[model samples]
Target: MKSRSVIHVTGAMNMGGTERMLMTLLRMKPPWKSIFLTYGTGTGTFDQEIKDLDGEIRTIPNPGSLSDHFQLFRTVKPAAVHAHTLFQSGIPLAAARAAGVPIRIAHAHTTADPSDKKGRFIYEKLMRASIALSATDYRACSSAAGNYLFAGKSFEVMPNLFDPKQFKRPPEAEVLRLKLKYGWTDKLVLGSVGRLTKVKNHAFMLDMLSELHKQGIKAVLLVVGDGDQLKTLRRKAEELSVAELVTFTGAVEDPSIYYHLMDVFLMPSLFEGLGIAALEAQASLTPVLGSEALQPEADLGGGLLYKLPLEAGSAIWAEKAISVATDSHKGTSDPVAVPPEEVLKHYYQLYRWKGGGHEQKTADYII
Candidate 1:
C-alpha cells in the first residue's frame, strides 16, 4: 500500500523538545511519509538531526497570514498535520481544516509562554481555537502544558521521550576532562543547558553560584546554548567573581557528551513547559538541581530539588546549594553507557499510529 504523508508544521527548526520529537518520529519507517514546515528560511541543529534521521524538510516561511495557509495547503498534500510551534498553530490548523485532513494534532510542550503575559494569553486562546477547529486530539508532555493549551478541552499526556542509547558514555570521555582546559578541574561543576534568557533565570543561577563561592564550596558553572542574554549572563558571572568558573559553550549539537562532565545539573528557571535539557541529562544519569517554580521532581525521578528562599539572600541560597550538591549524582565522570533501543521503538509506534489514522484505533473503547 502507498504510504500516507504525515506533514509536521512548526516555526523554527531549532534544537528543542518539540522538534526533537518530530525528528524521532521521522527516524523510523512507518506507514506514513513525513515532511516539515519552517517559517524561517535557514536551518540549524535540527535540520542536521532530521537529515541524520533520514527525514525531509520543506519550507513555509510565510505562515503568519491565512493566505499563507492557502498557499501551503496547495503546495503539500498531507494526510494529517501536527503543529509543534505555538505561533504557527492557528495557520497550519486552519490550512488542515481547509485541506480536510482527518487527523490534526496540536503538540503543546510548555505550561505557559514565559515570553510575555499578554503573548501567553493570546497564544492560549489561539491554541484552543486551533484544536476546536482542526485537531483530532491535543498532546502535551505535562499537565501544566495541557491545562494551558486546552482550557476547557480534554488533552492527552505523552512524557518527554529521550533515546537513552544515543548518549552512551564514552570510554575516554573528554566532556569532563576538557573542562580542565578552562580551569574547572579542582572546582565542582554545576551545569545547566538552555538559551540564556530571563525565563531561564541565568541571573539567579549566577546569584546562587556567587553564594556557593562565598561559602568556599569551590564550584563552577558550565552553561550550553547561546542567545541575547549571553553577554549579560557572562557579565553577571564576572561581577559575581565567578566568571573564571563559568563557561558558556554557545549551543552545541549533542549536549549528552557535555552532560557527562557535570557534578550536578542545575535548572533554576522562572518557568518551564518542558525541560528537555534536564530530561537528556537525567537519561544520561546526571543528578539534577532545579528551581521550585518548575517541577523538576515530577519530571526527573531522582534529583535534588531546591526552591529559591523567600528571603532571597546569599546565605540561604548557598546553604541550599551545599545541601543539594553534596547529595547530587553527576553520571560518574563519563562511565560507559549504551542507549536503550526502545527510543526508536517508541517513535515507531507514534509514526505507525499517525500513518494508519483512525482505522487502527479501536472504536469500542470510545475513550
Candidate 2:
C-alpha cells in the first residue's frame, strides 16, 4: 500500500510559535508523511530537522501567483493543504480547491497583526472571502485567533501540543553551568522567550528590570531568542542603564532547557493567538507573569500563571514579578496534566476526517 501525505504551507519554518507547533507535529511521526511548503526560496531553522525526519521541504515564490500555487498543487497532488500564513492562506487554499485537494485547511495562529496597513484592508477582505469559499475546515490555536480570522464562521480550536518531558528540570551540574555561563548566580533571574519583535513587548521587560533595580533588587533578565529588534532592545537597555542586568541569548533550539534557569518567566506581548512560551514555562514549573493582553486559555489551569495590564507600568509589573518569584509555594504546583498522545490524537482525527464517509479516509494528503 502506498503511504499518504500532507503539505503544510507556512512562512519560513523559523523558531516562531506556529513553526514550532508544526515541528512538534512532524516529530510525533503522525500516520501520514509531512511536507512543508515554505513561502520563499530560503532555509529555515527547522529545514534540516524536517529532512532528518523523512519530511520534504519545498518553496513557492513569495506571494506566489495563483497559477504558480495551482501548478504546484497539481504536481504534488497532496491529499490536503494546510495553510498557516493567515489571510495569505486564502490564495493557496483557493489553489488547493482548484487542484481538487480534499482536505483544505486554513489554520489561524494570531489574533492580530500590528503591521497591517490601511491599504491592506481590501486585500484582507478579498482573501477572507476566498478562504471562506475554498477551505473545507478551519482551525485555530485559540478562540480569539479563530474569531479574529474566521469571524462569523465556525472553527475548531486546536491546542498547540508540546512534549512536556522536554521541560523537566535539567541535572544540577547543567543548571549550574548555564547559571555560570550567563552570570546568573546570586541574581534574581527573570526570563522571557520569543523572537525579539515589537509585538512581543520585550522593551517593557527592560523597563521592569530597571524598576527592580530602582527598588534595590539584585534582579537580572535573560531574554532568549533572536529577531530584528535586538539592536533596538540593547540600546533601550543602555539608555535605561539596565544593560548590565539584561542578557539576550540568541535563538536556542531547545529553549525548554533554559526554563529551568529562570526564577520567573515574563510575557508582556501586545497580543497572542495563544502564548506557547507561557505554556512551556508553566510546564517547567516556572511561575509566569504575563500581560493581560494574553488570552486566558494560556493559563493551562496552572496556579503559577499571573496576569496584569500593561497600563499598570513596569513598576507594578516588577513588584508582581518579585512577589511571584519569592513565594515559597512557587514551583510546587504542577501544570495541568496533558497527555502527549491525547494531543497528537487531535491532529490524527483532524487529518482522518473528510466531511464524512470512509472513501475520503484513504486520501491522506496534508499541507
Candidate 3:
C-alpha cells in the first residue's frame, strides 16, 4: 500500500512548542510519512530527530509568499497539508486549495501576537479572511488559539501532547548536580522555557528579578531557549542591574534537567495558546507563575498554576514567585498526563478522514 503523505508547515522545525509537539507525533511512526516545510533555514535543535524518524524537512526562503507556497504545494502533491502557524496561514492554505489538495489543515498555535512588527495586524486580518476561504479544517492547541484564528467557526482543540513520564521529577542528587554544574547553588532558582521573544514578555521577567533583589530575596533566573530578543533581554537585565543573577542557556534538547533545578517556574507572556513549559514545570513538581493573558486551560486544573495580570507589574509577580518557591506543599506528584500515543492516534485519524481515506476507530480519544 502506498503511504499517504502529510506535509507540515511551520516557522521552523525548532524546539518551539508546535515543533516539539509535531516531533512527538512523528515518534509514533504512523502509517503515513511526515514532511516538514519550514520558513527558517531548516536547521534546528530537532533536525537530527526528524531525520532519524525518516521525516523530510524542507525550507522556504520566503514564508507566506504565495508563489513559494504554490510551488511547494505543487511539488509535494501531498494528500494533506497540516500548517502549524500563527496568524499568517493564508498563503499556504490558498496554495493548498490551488493545488487541489483534499485536506488543508490550518493549525493555530498561539492566541497572542508575539511580534510588534509593522503591518502585522493588517496582514493577519487579510490572512484570517483568506484562511476562512481556503482551509478545509481548523485546529488549535487551545480554545484561545481557535477563537483567535477561527473565532465562531468550528475548530478542534488539539492538545499539545508529550511523554508525561519524561517530565517527572528526577532524583534529588541529579537535580543538585545539575544546579551545581550551572553554578546556581544555595539560591532560590526561578526558571522559564520558551523563545526569548517580546510576546513571551521575558523583559518583564528581568524586572521581576530586580524586584526580588530589592526585596532582598536571594534568587537566580535561568532562561531556556534563544531568539531575536536574547540580546535585548540581556541588555535589559544589565540595565536593571540583575545581569549576574540571570542565566540564558540558549535552546536545549531536553528541558527536564533544567525544570528539576527550578524552585518555581515563571511565564509572563502577553498571551499564549497553552503554556507547555508551565505544564512541564508542574510535572517536575515545580510551581508556575503565569500572566493573565495566558489561557486558563493552561492550568490543566492543577493547583500549582498561578495567573497574575500583566498590569499587576513585576513586583507583584516577584512576591508570588517568592511565595511559591518557599511553599513546600505546592508541587504535585501526579501531574496532568498527556499520553503521546493517544494524541498521535487522534491526529492520524483526523488526517485519514481529511484525506478521504479509511478512518480508524478512535472513539475513546478526547481533545
Taking the tens digit of each residue's C-alpha lDDT, what string does model 2 give over 1-367? 3227788998678778888778888888876789988876766878889999999998877565898889888898887799998998999999999998778999998899676677788888998999999999999988999999998899999878888787888888999998998888889999988788999999999999999898899999999998889999999999999998888888776788788999999999899998988888888988999987778778877688889999999999999998998888765656884666777766666666433222245544432
Runs off by more than 4 Å, candidate 2: 1-3, 353-367
The predicted structure with the larger TM-score, 1 or 3, is: 3
Residue 244: error of model 3 in Å?
1.4
Candidate-wise lDDT, in order = 0.66, 0.85, 0.80
TM-score of candidate 2 against the unseen true structure: 0.93
Error of 1 at 226 (Å): 2.0
Model 1 off-target regions past 4 Å? 1-3, 27-31, 117-127, 172-176, 296-300, 303-315, 328-367
Write model 1 residue lDDT over 234-307, tens digit each, in one string.
88888888888788888666677777787677777677676766667766666666665565423544333345
List TM-score per model, in order.
Answer: 0.82, 0.93, 0.92
Each candidate: how many clashes? 6, 7, 0
Cα distance off (Å), candidate 3, residue 190: 0.4
User: Can you write out model 3's per-residue Cα lDDT over 1-367, one digit (the tens) per residue?
Assistant: 3226889987787677777777777886776778988875546888888888999887888885888888887887887888877666788889889988777899988886666699888887888888899998888888988998886889998767777778777788998888788787889898898777787888888998999898898889999998889999888899989999999999887777888888888899888888777777777777888987677667755668887888998888898898887776674445566667667656766775332233555523211
Model 1 weakest lDDT span, ten residues long:
358-367
lDDT of 3: 0.80
